[model samples]
Target chain A: MGKNVLLVDDSKTMRIIIGRSLRQAGIDFDNIFEAADGIEALEVLEKETVDIVLSDINMPNMDGISFLREKSTRDAIKDIPVLMISTETGDDIIGEAKSLGAVGAIKKPFTPDKVNEVLGPLL
Target chain B: MEIQDKMIDATKEIFSTMIMMEINLEEITDVHGPLTDTITAMIGLAGKRKGVLAVHFPYPVALAITSSFLMMDVEEMNDDVHDAMGEIANMLGGNIKTILSENGRDIDLSMPSTIAGSEYSFQSDKDVEKVIISFSTEKGSFMVEMDLEK
Candidate 1:
């Protein structure tokens, strides 16, 4: 079966840009899902069969750290790898994310080449 | 390099990598006049360093940036423009935070917000050390201003 990816961000513009970057990087997916925040992301993960998640750290309703904490407790979605695409590149924050099961991260203001460099290995 | 130089580099990188537009540094100043027919997006920095990062864009430049961002033609100021501008400020704010704080735990960044008007003033009532860097794009020019508490 083909892999699917989910994008979680509050900004519609960012979601569109990420999707565009994925296409520009020649990373095609059978399905691409989206959510506005961690709560919506969790809901999508529960309902959809997603291979990976690309999320933003700062968001309304539920932020990325809280989302990781919440997702870790659920067995059904616990194993799904998440790669962060955010402006938050702080060691403390990224370290916390890695501790919570995030596979890796891509900083904001990144190029398609950067996206490919970071996300290619996981795929 | 000074904070001003870092800000300039960050702004250029954002424009070049994400917006697919090359921007040249116009000037660096501590103050600017009132804005007209422009949109401003800002993000707050709290915790160890209290300040705000703002980006001011004229209507044409903003529309062009938004258009380039989405790879579509944008002729009007809409939610997409606001969101795109806000995200730019967010990214800049994150970069500023990295510059200000080494570990990133000492500071916190507020969600990005925006204000647009035909005419208005952007100033700080509190004492601040301000640095405003202006840049020019093919469409027009814009400014990135940072106000840190003194």
Candidate 2:
């Protein structure tokens, strides 16, 4: 069965592009939820069952790192894997995401192949 | 790699992968005159390097990119076009920031802003190092300018 996925990003265009790339990567999802930021993503989680999350690091009103930290403390959603997608190449940022229970990270301007490579085993 | 090369590569990659537009570097030149009938997006960077990165698109080029990005025909440069342009700048600036930070420069990017008009002009501060590069696609041409105070 396809997994349920949640996409969090402030940019509408980026959400669409990431959705397209996910499909192109052959990672089918039973349900794909979209949120403008981490705050909205938590709202989505309140009502939906998400098996994985793909989020961008920078956003207004709750960024991805904060979301990961929040998700890490929640028993209901803590097990669901989170993958960060951002243009941030800082080692410290990536390390922080990893410590917060992010399964992996994907840099921006990612191709379908790169997406598949990072998410294939996890999904 | 040099900063200019990194910016060029980031622009090419983002346009090609995200927007599905094949863009080639045309030339790297000095800052130009006022851009009429254009849309511009700017994002600021702070920390180890303080600067602003701006992307300027002619109306036709902006329309084409907006259409491709939203998967609809954008005849007029409206809010959607403005948002699309801003997102493009954010991605471009974000990628450039990552490249710089990886090479030993720490930088933080600010939220992007977009403006669409025909009569405005863009000028950088005198102390900043300005690098302007022009890129061409089949649809039209645009420029990416980076002004950094390192």
Candidate 3:
């Protein structure tokens, strides 16, 4: 069985698109999780063991940043590497995510190659 | 804040970050207003200020941007073109909503809608200022043209 991964974003369309990308990048697993936003993602986290987190920056009710902060304090969740995918690209936001505890950053409108590049080493 | 400034800032932010392209804003003399966009993605914003903000792209430019953005080749504009344009607008609008919310003018954003057709011209109403900010991406040229009023 491949490693379990959790994908988080607000848009259903995006979630589906990214989910397909993940499959194409050889993330063949039945345990792949999806969440509408960070809050819901946390709920999923509390129950299951996720190998890595792929999240979008812009989401409602506790954004990805807040989720990263919360994940850092939890002993069970802290070890999982997080990859931030977003449209809001700036040095500040990327730095903040890294400082707050994301393993890598990928900008939006991504290709399969980029997705594989980000996930290849960690997963 | 003027809608024009809002447009310049947001468009620059999105295009530069996502496409790795810089946009130059030069006002066109033949302002097509709302209809000037050969390909337009618009959404209804309701709140203290209610209006539609459309991101318009020319046919070839639209195809190029959409192809690069989605990592696919688009020979011509079709349903996929409309969906792609709507998504691009959604991104720009989503960022705009955040900016507007911070300024204490909150609004709900409707899903993006697109219009692509031949032989169409859009001119803003007389009271409203129809501003066109011209930009060239690595792919081609496009504009963020709008008609709005408080």
Best by TM-score: 1
Ranking by TM-score: 1, 2, 3
RMSD of 1: 0.7
In model 3 chain B, which range of ten residues has the least summed lDDT?
Answer: B28-37
Q: lDDT, candidate 2, residue A4? A: 90
Error of 3 at B93 (Å): 1.1
Clashing pairs in 3: B35-B122
Name model 3 segments beyond 4 Å from true: A6-123, B1-3, B28-30, B33-37, B103-105, B123-129
lDDT (tens digit, per residue) of candidate 2 on A38-80: 9899888878989989999888899999998998888888888
TM-score, structure 3 vs. true: 0.58
Residue A8 lDDT in model 3?
93
Question: How well does candidate 1 score on lDDT at residue B2?
Answer: 100
* Better lDDT candidate (1, 2): 1
Quote the positional error of residue A75 for candidate 3 in Å.
Answer: 20
Preferred candidate (TM-score higher): 1 or 2: 1
**What TM-score does each model's chain B reach against the true chain B?**
0.99, 0.93, 0.80
TM-score of chain B of 2: 0.93
